[model samples]
Target chain A: MLEKNKNLLDIKKLKVSFFTEEGEIRAVNNVNFSIPNGKIMAVVGESGCGKSVTAYSILRLIQKPGKIMDGEIIFHPADDKPLDILKLGEKSDELYKIRGGKISMIFQEPMTALSPVHTIGNQICEAILIHQDVTKIEARKNAADMLAKVGIPNAKNRLDHYPFEMSGGMRQRVVIAMAMVCHPQLLIADEPTTALDVTIQAQILKLMKDLQKDLNMSILLITHNLGVVAQVADEVAVMYLGRIVERSDVRTIMKNPRHPYTIGLLKSLPSLSMEKTELPSIKGSVPSLTDIPNGCPFHPRCPYYKPKVCDAGNPPDLNAVDDNHDVACFRTSQIQNEIAGKERCRL
Target chain B: MNENIKNITSTPLLQVKGLCKYFPVFSKGFFKKQIGVVKASDNINFNLVTGETLGLVGESGSGKTTTGRAILRAITPTAGEVILNYKNELIDLTKISHKKLKQLRPFMQMIFQDPFSSLNPRMTVQDIIAEPLVIHKMAKGSVLEDRVIQIMKKVGLKPEHKSRYPHAFSGGQRQRIGIARALIMNPALIVCDEAVSALDVSVQAQVINLLSDLQQEFGLTYIFIAHDLSVVKHICDRVAVMYAGKIVELAKTNEIFENPLHPYTKALLSAIPSPDPDKPMNMNISGEVADPGNLPPGCAFAPRCEFCVQQCEQQIPKLKHLADDRYVACHRSWNVEDSP
Candidate 1:
């Protein structure tokens, strides 16, 4: 059952570009998605696919040479009215008020995301005092409690520990505690578990899921692992060359994947059945941003690429394949047939 | 049990017995000396048969990488013996002289985890692949270029890419260049240390396939080390699970996945997110992996193991054969009849 909270974040046609010396590289191209209150939406894609850029664009964290060229990021904060996040400058006091106060982000690399010199407890308390009008003593106690809530053992004792003092898993938990101390309405986690081992990765993922239930905050999870998306995501968006090729419920995308890129990703994963001799991989690499193919960005590696349509012109936006399922492919039927054929033969 | 030992009678290409590597922590004092030792690998024993893949699966700082480096003689081992069977003659690699080791280096090669760092930045792909050949005096002149092109083709690279440097290629293609260099020696055993873990899922499959095909074609054995269980399952014939510095479990790939015996292996397998969205994951393991330097008294995993008992904390479990080819290092393996 879905939660009864209102839509906390609405993003429409978000186009982000980077002014590189080579040329203007389009990192996020006309991406559109929304996160309902307490829901987790996963954006899955390979490297250089703009999943991270989309998350950064929402928090207005895009650095120099990169700008949100067009689109709207309407965030209806829990305590305040709706506001466009893109219009707020980085140094503006309004943005500083909302950056870590209303919306928090957990980066991929814990070592770099955290300050090397500051204690983990101080970092968490800093977040708490920045947003909430809390005293230093209360913030320290609250930070310890938050750390304990994320399952960090001896949290009170380790309050003075630096980032290097803890293991990767513990450091990540500290990061999560800092992000959640503010009780933000929307949390953006970019590849949170990519650097951790499988066991630690599972623990962090479960912590995020459980915290979402208790805190009732929407999450925009950006990752490249389809396995992770299957576990924690309610909705899935497959990105290719900065465009959303498919967006649907986790079940629809996994069970009936329509886009060729998504299908290729699923096929590429090694299964436990141990029956197949060789894993089937997509043919080629992602085209460079400066040398993006004309029509479909995935045509070079797509196995079911049609000659005239996929090569001559761009494919349309996501068309509804089912009630909540949408795909942006002109040859979904043919790709589905190919996937079914492979499944039948394997069976 | 005796018959099982007898079944492994063939001369292994490489055999490591009681291998241990300890790094000494030196302080700047009047008599600067070894203060303490970081026991990276603790009495690890394994045998790699010719033309078979032996996967080494472990978490970070588990000594899996150290074990690979010790086998290649890249780092000096504090104690132990490494025997290599070259052309039906047993050669003790541990006691060999430095000059002789250099002569013997051509037959053994390693593929590093990151392709970007492994390749030379200033050299072309052709030069990188042919460096081993030139150093070993195997080929020169146009023959070296032809051989480099040939090996590149074998690894799914075009001949035209030989002149380009490693920076010009993608991660997958750069890994292919690393593979070409490793295979150029026609090494009997190749140690792949997290070789494909740095690649994309789709690109990982391609490199794995190329490795397997090369293995079949050249009768090459591999000590494939990785942290990903699924990738290890696909490429390895037998797998070893490591914790801290000890191998906790070793079994056939199918047996290890189907009937995992060790508690740590069970937790690891259960933690891997299955692609089936309808199936709810059994993600219930608690506590983080303990630091290697400050491990528990007996079993390194006893602190995090849910099935730990008093005996587990007092006595270190020895790796023992349980079934036909399965080996597990856990005192509670007999108590837990089946793994869920």
Candidate 2:
């Protein structure tokens, strides 16, 4: 029932696994989501939840020992026919053009992304030269313009400054400038502002939001901070142990979460609005990938764990709970009934 | 070891006055000429009451960690007095000898941030927790092991996992082991330096709750140092907001959150992105943190503060008592409007 042109990227039954020495680590299992054109979609989760791995699979950036077993990553450009990114050859020019020209990704660490030896101007100009047919001088000018647009003061002189010469916030701004210099259609930002201070983080988030609007680009934002998602994202998907447990608009997901894991996560976050002596914590920590329990990965830490119902059968699928909200819990109906009963008893 | 010492709670458990720690910077040459000094902690003054948690909130390089280390005597301060109430007598930790400090080490312990790196990966959990008891000669072979198990159980770790190395445990479990190590000595004051910042969200909640529970059960005092205001609000009774080696604001937790006076404190509070979609993110202050090596002549935050005036740019402000139990270091605090 979904329209073809509305979604810029669609991930269908994507299954990614890492074959380690011990065994197969199910990094991403049967994940499904879509990034609509010009929309900011956030994938929120804790560590080892496969959110980064799922984002890495979109641009075919998964390295050796990790295989995209089966799935289709369809990309719909404005003027061209839809193409499956996963089916493209590794070294093909089509993939190369799409990698930086049509789609760009920013990593978690800005220091690692930019080379310390090369000047920032050289680094950013290199990105522009590879994707477009521009002269060296033109690329240099474009780099300065992009840097200025990202709120870097004295962008012209900053061209000669190395990555080490700038602060953490400045280096992050340089990374964003490199990612957005080519004006790509889809931007994948993974924990973009996690390393920065709170003031710097606000500036960067505002920069990203402004850039997204100016360029009319779609963003697949991956982060562990729900506050950032609430501030910027339009859609939210909560990931746990390689599966999308819940998906809805940001308001609905934050206000009326259906999954038990989502509820626990919201409750556990310390808020500034109220001071609490004891925060309601989830029972246990996230299990390692190799030692994940069977039948619903979150069941071990879930508070509403039943003996045979939640811990039995295969993991539930992402079923439609409402008109737009989706939840991957078999006990959604039971949990709702229990909540209603509690309300009646209180009344 | 003595039950009578616990009943006396007349005075503050710890008093830090004019604490300053400076590190000399050298020029890049063969001679290594002295260039300048980085005033990491300068004139830090506070009195921590008995069994109360005092939070030290600041950004990176704001000298919160240095202040914590100076109070514990882990690093020698440039000049200051860290007075602690021990055995119904006041003792200055800074003026003590190395051997004397070692004897007093068990009374004050620290829990570092990064649980993965804080614990000894080569040693088992039991050995790590019992090393304190062994060094102090408090217990022998079996008794030491028993004490370790008891503390581990108190911190919510299973006794069966005592023999496992740190590499086998999860992040949250490893943090529990860290807590057990800090709690084994029954220290009167515990310095938690971003103890819960490295954990996941759910695991962070667990550790925060565990810390409060331990504080209540033992009547322990804490100097909680972190940049996460939400966690500080939940756990701290009072908070001291540090900026550029200065205590910009010190107030009760509720007052600091609801009615911050200093410009830096207000900016920090507004900068926090709340986990609610209804609230929009707004940051009026701009620019990066001031450099400690070459701070401005006036207020260090004048370059980034939105409410900057000529006085703020020319003269530094002192931490003055504004109202009931509220201290703020701002030139225009008297004229600044209330929070919107």
Best candidate according to lDDT: 2
Query: How much does candidate 2 score in TM-score?
Result: 0.97
Q: Any runs in candidate 2 off by more than 4 Å, and if so which?
A: A1-4, B1-10, B338-340
True contacts kept of 1: 0.75
Model 2 Cα lDDT, one tens digit per residue, B82-158: 99999778999999999999999999999999998999889999999999988889998888888888998999999
Candidate 1 DockQ category? Answer: medium
Summarize candidate 1's per-residue lDDT along B1-340 as a digit string, tens digits. Answer: 2233346558778888989988777768888887676778888887878877889999998999998999889998889999999889899888999999988898899998998899999999999999999988999999988889899999999999888888899999999999999999989889999999889888988999999989889988899999999998998888999989889999988889998889899889999998888776796578777666667778889988888899999999998978876889999997866543
Instruction: Using DockQ, give the best candidate's number.
Output: 2
TM-score of chain A of each: 0.94, 0.97
Give me candidate 1's TM-score against the actual structure. 0.96
